[model samples]
Target chain A: MTEQELVQRAREGDELAFAQLVTDNEKRIYNLCRRLTGNPDDGAELAQEAFLNAWRGLGKFHGESSFATWLYRLASNACIDFLRREKRRRSLSMTVSLDDEEEGRQAELPDQGAGPEERLERAEDRRAIARALEQVSPEHRQVLVMRELSGLSYAEISQVLGLEEGTVKSRIARARAALRKRLLAEGNFFGGASSTR
Target chain B: MCDCEKALDWISLDLDGALTPQERRELEDHLAVCPGCAALARELAALHRVLPELEEEVPEGFQQAVMERVRAEKVQALPAGRGRAVPWRRWLSLAAVCAVVLAGAGSLGRFWDRSGGTEPAAGETLPVQAAQAGAAAQAGAAPQEEAAPQKEAAGEGQGPELRLYTAMADPSGAREAADSGEVLPEASPLPTVGAAMNQAAAQNEDLTEAQRAALTANCAAWLQTSGLDPAEAGLLTVEAVTQTDLEAAVCPGEDQRARLDLDDYRVTLGSSDVLLCDSATLEVLGYLPTV
Candidate 1:
């Protein structure tokens, strides 16, 4: 069945139809979450919560946009909320150690290159980039992730973020500039170009 | 001015294919002559390449976990009486109850008209009547003759029993009764339901659990009357119960106040139909067909 047909059936309370919808978009949603949260476990949980919310609020899906776009909006909101709450908790408690968090994140990066030396260098480059990304503000990071990672069109990002198209374009441009500047400052981009690439 | 700043501006847009063809040509020509701009563009391209490769895979059974949660929420939202068999009998009982309450309300309207009582303002009638009935019942006085028909209707027990009482004695009558320690009669289920929903909606809170259940039940009753099968048509799940402003065009005049005012719960079912219900009386004020 077409996606619209599946959505129609799902609306009619067909569990199978809804499951099919989940199956179709799970990877993209999961990847989006993984990138946003920078943690696989947290990404999985956020992705699941987003789907559950989508199921509950499915009636509000007016089909003015594609199902994937609608789902992206929900997943994005869930990630943003999670990040906000985490930020608040960290600020309030002051118990979370940044070094420990970075160590945990380092262990999560995949190690696959032509050889051990190359792999180690690649991992270092990955860590540097990730750390730089973490330093960027959430608003800029979000637009950058949507544009570069999720590969959404500026128009699609505008709809998902509820921003004007011009706003989306400018934000994305700013995000790119910010990210590049941060990587450069950290000596991860232009400084060690030969080894990093 | 040097074309360098403009080239930098166009770099990200060029990668995104967002630059105009003319602009793209200008940037390309600038980059060819200016090795600095060309190298900057290359670095931006490399950053784009690395971002996507960083996304990691989620753990196994993620889909299973999400589906499990969805099933659990669905089961919880289903009415207690829902069974393997369709709920036609329950629908019938609901229909019968609605008929009784509506009939009783019509009769009460006629009674008021005959007694030379004007129709009270939108906010006035129910609270006043409730207070008066509470006082009269507490005093051990029999309800006036005008309430007899409604009392008989309540005795049938097929639907929500509306307590008949005098219209508000005055604008502040209900408040006065409350302050004086006069117990207000238990409001008939309909208006109390309406009042509670209106209060919650005004605060923009999600419906309380009881209110959510009532809304689901109300939607079921409406689907039955519309000749749609709640179970088969997927109208069973109450996705949302929210209060929205009624457009004057959709609901006109006093009818708008009756139907669209704070008293209406906009019940969203599954992914389709939206039913506007009078929170006070469980009346389906407006129905938007499933999209």
Candidate 2:
């Protein structure tokens, strides 16, 4: 069944249906949270919170949108909400490390394990991208992350964010420009690959 | 038309296949002759190919973690029996986890207080109670006596509180949400708790509109200036299907289907049930038959 169908069923007090959704998209959503929050712990928490919120709010979900879109909305809001709370609010910086993330992605990547040197190199690139991302506005960062990390189409992004598609496109374009600028300033954007200006 | 100016416009429209046939022909003609623009297009295409890179990978056992939490929450949903069996050590660990998760959903806490610890003093039956109870049961998977006890507490008519998720430090954050504004996306968990589930709270549409506007502005300001990365954020395409046909502008071709078209937005609120709407002012603009 479609994601929306699952949501409809779950809203009708179906725990199994909600559980199925948790199984189907948990990995992607978890990973999306991890990348955005930059900490496995926070990502895990946010993912859990989103699911809980989704399960509780399922009945209220209107089919005016796709279930994924609705889930993404909850997930995004969960992240924002998490950042606002005490005890876990660490300047919005995550306590999780990218090294551990590689160990996790290793599960899905072609190579289960990479040499330390290769892994370290990948980690550094990730850090660079993450740091660059940290410099942009949250809206811009959201658009970039949703576009780059969540792989949402412009239309989907627009729907999830309740913004016009032009706004989504413009923000993404600007985010790319900003990330390019920051990375360039750091002299790490094109460390090995030459970028044609 | 192949010149950089028109080329840029075409690039945007072409990405969505919105260009007319004649415009497509002219744009292609320009692409064929313009080497500089062609290189730029190639670069853009390459970037498009890597669009997937923008999305990232979740940590290991992310799902396991979610399931563990969900299971733990479910246990919490159980009556007093669930937590009585939770060993102290295990309970402590779960307690730590629950504290963290609930913090992530501040709306849950606020809602619970508004509804859980109190009832409308003069025999007011709240229809929104069902939403709160269900959420309390499902998400309140906490220590034993999960959500029921808290809501039952509210039902007994005691004090209540509402939690705000924002820091409200930004100058722009000063404005309260328009009670009817779409900015209050954080209203989800509140419904399950006391505040959101209480349709009576929603009865104050003026208040809701104000709150909604303020919340939207608060989020917008954050979206505009905050440096924090978003876990997920995107534009949503909304397609509006009118319940009535008289004044509704249905998209061509689809007899029973209508697209929720606004100025550059299109969504088909096709199948999902709408539980509540303060007003049906969701006016539609043009029709997107394709959508």
Candidate 3:
């Protein structure tokens, strides 16, 4: 069935249709959350929460935007809220040490099809990228992840973020520049070669 | 004419394919001379290439776990035919709170009499025989033989005397008389026991002269043992006599009555303590501090 028809069925209390919808979009939502949170466990949990929220709020969907866009908006807002709350929690307590988190991520990295050496290299590279993404401001990181990882168009991001298209475009460009600067400063980009500049 | 800054901006836009043909050409012309801007473009392109590689897959069983949670939540949200079933723990907590409030109000309700009235006359009493007669009549029984025999068997030495004191201080008589248009004689200065008995008799016609005199003596005895110096505390008037469950303040949990015997009288002692006393013997049972 078409996504809209599936959404209609899901709205009418059809769990099978909703399950189908979840099956179709869970990968993108999970990846978006993963990139935004920079923690696989938190990403998986937040993705589930986002889908659950979408399920509960399906009755309010007016079809003004595509189902994917609406779902992305839900996931983005959930991640932003989680990040803000996590920031507050970190300020209040030092329970989650940075080294502990890094170790946790390294241990949790999935074994893709890559060999052991390649997997270790890929995990290290991922850790560096995630660490750099964490350095970027949450607002800029959000725009960058939605564009780069989720591959959302500027217009789609504007719709999801409730910003003007021009604002979205400038924010995406600034986000990329900020991320590149941070990555370069950390010597994680271009195989640690000194910048030509 | 585009400077390095504009050239970098165009290059960033070109990465997104957002640059127009003219803007792309303008950036290319500037990049041809600016190796720094050209290197920045290459680094930014490489950064973009690496970012998407970091996207992680959802953990296994995540979908099933979410669906399970969703199903459980949906089941809980569904309304039962009877109504929403309150959790047992919540119901128990609510019941406990209600019991506490009721126990507190029952304890405090005796002392906080909002209806203010004049003090009962001193030295007035109600006859024991008359009280028994009234009690018998109310119980739908023939007036029993003079209560003297029963009083003796019940270990009440001065049953008539205690009855007289209780009836004289009983505010219910005065309230009843007030409602029934019986104006009690004005307080007499240095009134003798006989005069007080007459006043009690005149106020409540239901009680005999002996009952009135006994009630007066009972009131006098209560005043003596009330632990309040009359000169300092002023005249201690009886407000209302009500039956109440023994509260911890009066009767500790170990001493609390297991059943409703109704033998205790909660005597409101004129802005003083609520004195719990035996209704038959007129002995002070316990005292609850008012202030």
Candidate 4:
């Protein structure tokens, strides 16, 4: 049966059909969570929560958009809410201080060469970028993940997030800038405006 | 250096391959003169290239875990008592009435047909209508003589404030209906906009100011999820509504209307436009352009 048919059956309380639907979209949804939260454990938990929400909210899932699109929205919301709560907790407790010069110096890159050192530094850069992503505001992180990680086009990101294309465009630009600033602060990248975290 | 800001914006867009040829050319021209922008563009481009590597594999047994939860929820959600049984019978009868009214009353029928014609489900759709049925049933059993006593009780502060505030367009008529003690019928045939508006407005004298505040907050939260600024929602007029009012306000298509549940409120965003949102989850049902 088609996904719409599965969705219809699931709407009428068909668990098997719903499971099938879940199997189909699990990877992307999990990845969406992982990218959004920057944690594998949180991604697994949030992805599950998103599907559970989808099950409870199946009645609400009118086929206005594709089921996958709906799942993305749900997954993104779960991750965003989790991040917001985490942010609040961090703010209250003052965790993850950015001023530690030791931590900041951890990813400092050497000038260009394609040696083993460069490859190792590139891996650190990737890890640093991922870490920097988590530090960006949830709103920016969300659009960034949708654009870069989830591979959603601007139009699709607009659709998934229910934003205007123009808004999505500008937000992605700002999100990139935010991530870049974070990377610069971490000393992962060589050149950018000299601003401290 | 004046062009640096614009160049940076273009560079971000350029990473996504979003820059137009002319824009790209302009960026290149600017980059040739500006070393800072050139370096920023190269780094941003490289960052964008590696972003996809961040995509993680779905952990083993992920689908199994999700399915396990889904099965658990289904078992939990299936009504244990006669709760599910009662709504099904009531919904069938109501659906029949809705079918007849929709077929015979051309405009109103079309309105509801577009409004998804009231799905006979266990969740979201049934609960509100079931509650409406319960309310109507109580009102039916109560004598018209009790209306006077109730009004007196309300006057003496024994009841909630009897002030009628309907989100309907015809405010005066709503006041009149409330005075006459007209509880909107569950799935009643509404022929005119006035009557339809009446169908939309079911006065809850018992709904507290706190409850209304909660409903407004729920809508504002849902509005945020719907990609609307909560401040924008604050500017719109809000009213607590049952499923009937939700249907009336969100008379777009079946898909949109099916999202509303019991106690969803309508936020009148414009004279003709409104938003329907579930109170509990604060999920936006849809935006409606009600005529």
Which one is best on DockQ?
Answer: 4
Question: What TM-score does chain A of model 3 get?
Answer: 0.81
Show the lowest summed lDDT stretch of 10 residues, model 4 chain A. Answer: A93-102
Can you tell me which runs of candidate 2 are displaced by over 4 Å? A81-127, A191-197, B2-61, B71-291
Restricted to chain B, the TM-score per model reads 0.27, 0.27, 0.27, 0.28
> In model 1, how large is the Cα lDDT of residue A145?
75
By lDDT, the candidates rank as 4, 1, 3, 2
Which DockQ-derived CAPRI band holds candidate 4? Answer: incorrect
lDDT of 2 by residue, B44-125 (tens): 4444434344344555565565555544444232222211122122222112222222333343444334423332232111
Interface RMSD per candidate:
11.5, 5.5, 17.1, 10.1
lDDT of 3 by residue, B1-291 (tens): 678757656666788899888878888888788877877888778767667766655678988977765553342211111122222212211122222222223432432342323232332111222222232222211122223323111112222222332233233433121122332233335345444434332332222333333433454465566644323122222212333334433542334333213434444444445555444333345556554
Question: What TM-score fits each model?
Answer: 0.52, 0.47, 0.51, 0.51
For model 4, what is the alpha-carbon lDDT of residue A124?
A: 60
Lowest lDDT 10-mer window, candidate 1 chain B? B83-92
Task: Give the per-residue lDDT of model 4 (tens digit) for A1-197.
Answer: 99999988777666788889888888779878876776677778999999988887777677888888988999998887887788777744212323232133233444466699776666666677777887787789888888887788888888899989988988888888888888877773754354331
Please give the clash total of every predicted structure, in order: 3, 49, 18, 0
Candidate 1 TM-score, C-alpha based: 0.52
Tens digits of per-residue lDDT, candidate 4, B1-291, equal 328768767887888788889888888898888777777777778788777766656777888888766654431122212211222222222222222222222323222322222322332222223323322332222112222223212122111112111101112222222344433233433344223322222322232223323434555665566555555332343334544565455433576567565435444552434676543333356766445
Instruction: Order candidates by DockQ, high to low.
Output: 4, 3, 1, 2
- Chain B of candidate 2 achieves a TM-score of 0.27
Candidate 2 docking DockQ: 0.11
Residues A43-155, model 2: lDDT tens digits: 77888788777765655677888877788888877765655462255664433355555444433332237787866665455566666666655566677667766667889
Better of 2 and 4 by TM-score: 4
